[model samples]
Target: MTAPVRTRSSEDLIRAEEPVLAHNYHPLPVVVSRAEGVWVEDVEGRRYLDLLAGYSALNFGHRHPALIAAAHEQLDRLTLTSRAFHNDRLAEFAERLAGLVGLDMVLPMNTGAEAVESGIKVARKWAYDVKGVPADRATIVVAAENFHGRTTTIVGFSTDETARAGFGPFAPGFRIVPYNDLAALEAAVDETTAAVLIEPIQGEAGVIIPDEGYLTGVRELTRRTGCLFVADEIQSGLGRTGRTLAVDHESVVPDVLLLGKALGGGIVPVSAVVANRDVLGVLGPGEHGSTFGGNPLAAAVGTAVVDLLETGEFQRRAAELGAVLRDGLTGLVGKGVVGFRSRGLWAGVDVDPALGTGREVSARLMGEGVLVKDTHGSTIRLAPPLTITEDELLNALATLGRVLERSV
Candidate 1:
């Protein structure tokens, strides 16, 4: 007879993985075994509020009923057919997602990195075919300190040394410009430029928000320069922000929108390149494809996610609760937090360095039964699930305040 699986303690499980697992990530010492809306439990049954929300991948919270139901239903019906044959669910998913983002077509992919890579390829092709850039001379301009993905091409243009240090002999045909600076972006673009790729809010750069009108300026500039404006909203889109997209705050639309993260609804890996036909039409079939990109499983879950967004409830919640978040952070400023940048439900907090490093604060928060992640040196990011209640948000904020108070 087959033996039943043995349960392991958190420490025991963590220790066991020391040898087998790669050390690419330095996660906080918490072992989450299961999760529900806004909360997760470790093996020992200790529950903590999930403040980071899987880096915005779980914007609907863990195991959302709709997303889960969609996945279960699709699993029984069909999972993948490998793009060789069409699936019933793909058309609905593509159509709904395009409508959600005000786009013409959708190129489904599997991960954030794949979406970024796909956007780059589409832009270059559009440049060559439509813009008539010389062969092999299509240049793309990117902002410094951008974090599109970890792919080789994406990292090649990254200003962060940690991501770029050992990953070179990097890709060329890319130019670097300062983010949130219109003059710098204008100087970088020329006849060879195909697209100007940027993250609406630089999530990995400590949630840096640009000044007002920056996105509008980019839209105007790209239009005038005859270059596609590709907005990488992998971390900022899908109702995590107050609107359907961060660009919506400015009422500006880019030629291409790269979306992922919460596009999967925390159930499966799903991503897409969304663009109008004029920009995305440069590619013929077989120029780019993924075996599992538009599979039935992803399509079902993604369609459900769109259904949720179309209700506009999550976006409204984020906007209303975002004020609470902003108020809480503002109160903490000069107490334990030095400063912060926030939009909707997303925030990057800079705690007083004298108290501790961001990692230290995160570990302390973990001890206090809250989960958050630290980035850079002294910055910690908070992007809780949209399903989080006001009381739960208050409790988490109070817990942060308490941790800072105790440390002080």
Candidate 2:
């Protein structure tokens, strides 16, 4: 008989991590051992409702059966086959993803940052090759408080000092404008502009949703200026926002769509830059590639993710459950909750500073058997998995209410 595995306590694991791991992230104290659906089990066997859902990466929830089965089947057959040669699963994944997003072609990448970088390159290339922009003089415009990724180039344009401080001397040829301000965006777009990259809903900057008609205005401006409109939907896409893509809310289509996060079904890191042929086809042979971008395992998992979206069940769940979330949060407004912004099931709740900081509130919630994450100073972001049952979600909210009341 095999020896049973001995599990270490959460304290022991946390102590083990303190010395060796990089001090980049200040995560919540709870140490998760396993998770399924909307709940996570700590090493000490305590279960907590998961409200963050890995920053929307686990939109389908942890260890989804279909995704797991797909990954298992791929693992048994094949895994990696770098872009140096073709792989069996890549074409189908690309086709299905493209069809789902209404794009013509797909450039697979490993992470959201890579997809954004690739989109930047494609836009610059398109500006020179198709739009007749001067070489190396092309510029891309981005919104203020944007949280595309943490790459050097991506961080260079960030308005947040924490993300940019000491990370540069950074890259240039990028312009920044206030988010949701159409006048500023219009004024920034000129003849040398290659593209305008914006997130449909800014996830990292406290789930900031733009004003109505902002997306449509962006589309019209991009069209009039002959520049590509790149939507970084890495966090806001993939059925997290009760829509196939956040842009779908306005019925506006971007010239380039950057997707990631849930594309791997919370199983692997899979991302892609999707666009029409005229935009994505600007790259010639050897221009851009990734060693493990379209690997068999990622493709297999991505195909499964697309299949899940095809059923439209997750999207429906987010939309229906989102109403409940909104109502619950609204009821807490004056009770230690100052305000909140939400769409679908994703929310950024601002706890009154009189109670405590967002981090303190998060810790209290953890103590109450709920797991959430804090951003900025007083804002706690809530994005439970779409698979969360109504009862489970309400229970989590009740825990949140109790935590707030205790803090007060």
29-116 per-residue lDDT for model 1 (tens digits): 8888878899898877888999999899999999999999989999999999989999899999999999999999999999999999
Query: Candidate 1 vs. truth: CA RMSD?
Result: 2.4
Once superposed on the true structure, which residue ranges of model 1 sit more than 4 Å away at CA? 1-6
After superposition, candidate 2 runs with Cα above 4 Å error: 1-5
TM-scores of all models? 0.98, 0.98
Look at candidate 1 and tell me the lDDT of residue 338: 95
Angstrom error at residue 116, model 1: 0.2
Top candidate, metric lDDT: 1
Residue-wise C-alpha lDDT for candidate 2, range 1-408, written one tens digit per residue: 123235987789888999999999888887887788877888767888889988888999999999999999999999998988899999999999999999899999989999999999999999999999998999999999999999999999999999999989998999999999999999999999999999999998899999999999999999998999999999999998899999999999999999999998889999999999989889999999899999999999999999999999999999999999999999899998999999998999999998999999999998888889999899999999999999988888888888888887
User: How does candidate 2 score on lDDT?
Assistant: 0.93
Question: Could you tell me the lDDT of residue 108 within candidate 1?
Answer: 97
